[model samples]
Target: MAAPGCFMEHIAFLEASDDPAATTVWKEHITDDESEGRTA
Candidate 1:
């Protein structure tokens, strides 16, 4: 329900994230150990 080309951006929040892409965090949360192959 917002205007076109305009939306709330959460980059500030994400930039402060411990897991920027939420990749590893989600993997660990779901008990998937495969994230060990990831490179930062």
Candidate 2:
């Protein structure tokens, strides 16, 4: 199981992220940004 604090951190990481290239790179493993696509 994951910790509550870790879950919140993950949410923040996803919310604050703005780099498409980086998002795409990270998406290679996690699909959170799949629908959004590149944000420029």
Candidate 3:
């Protein structure tokens, strides 16, 4: 019913997060590599 559909939408939103923490970690790694004169 409508409740199940709403629940699925909520689950989808949670799963869709691009994970900012993970992105920040990746950017930091790239920055470190750049400082070391390496490519990302």
Q: In order, what lDDT does every prediction score?
A: 0.38, 0.43, 0.40
Q: Which candidate number has the best TM-score?
A: 3
Writing each residue's lDDT as its tens digit, candidate 3 over 1-40 gives: 2332242222212344587565443223334445446774
TM-score (all chains, Cα) for each model = 0.17, 0.18, 0.22
In model 1, the Cα lDDT at residue 35 comes to 29
Query: Residue 32's C-alpha lDDT in candidate 1?
Result: 23
- The all-Cα superposition gives candidate 3 an RMSD in Å to the true structure of 17.4
Stretches of candidate 1 off by over 4 Å are 1-14, 23-40
Query: How would you encode candidate 2's per-residue C-alpha lDDT over 1-40 as one tens digit per residue?
Result: 3433343224323455676566644433433343336434
Worst lDDT run of 10 residues, candidate 1, spans 26-35
lDDT of 2: 0.43
Tens-place lDDT digits, model 1, residues 1-40: 3334454332223355676566434322321232233343
Question: Once superposed on the true structure, which residue ranges of model 2 sit more than 4 Å away at CA?
Answer: 1-16, 26-40
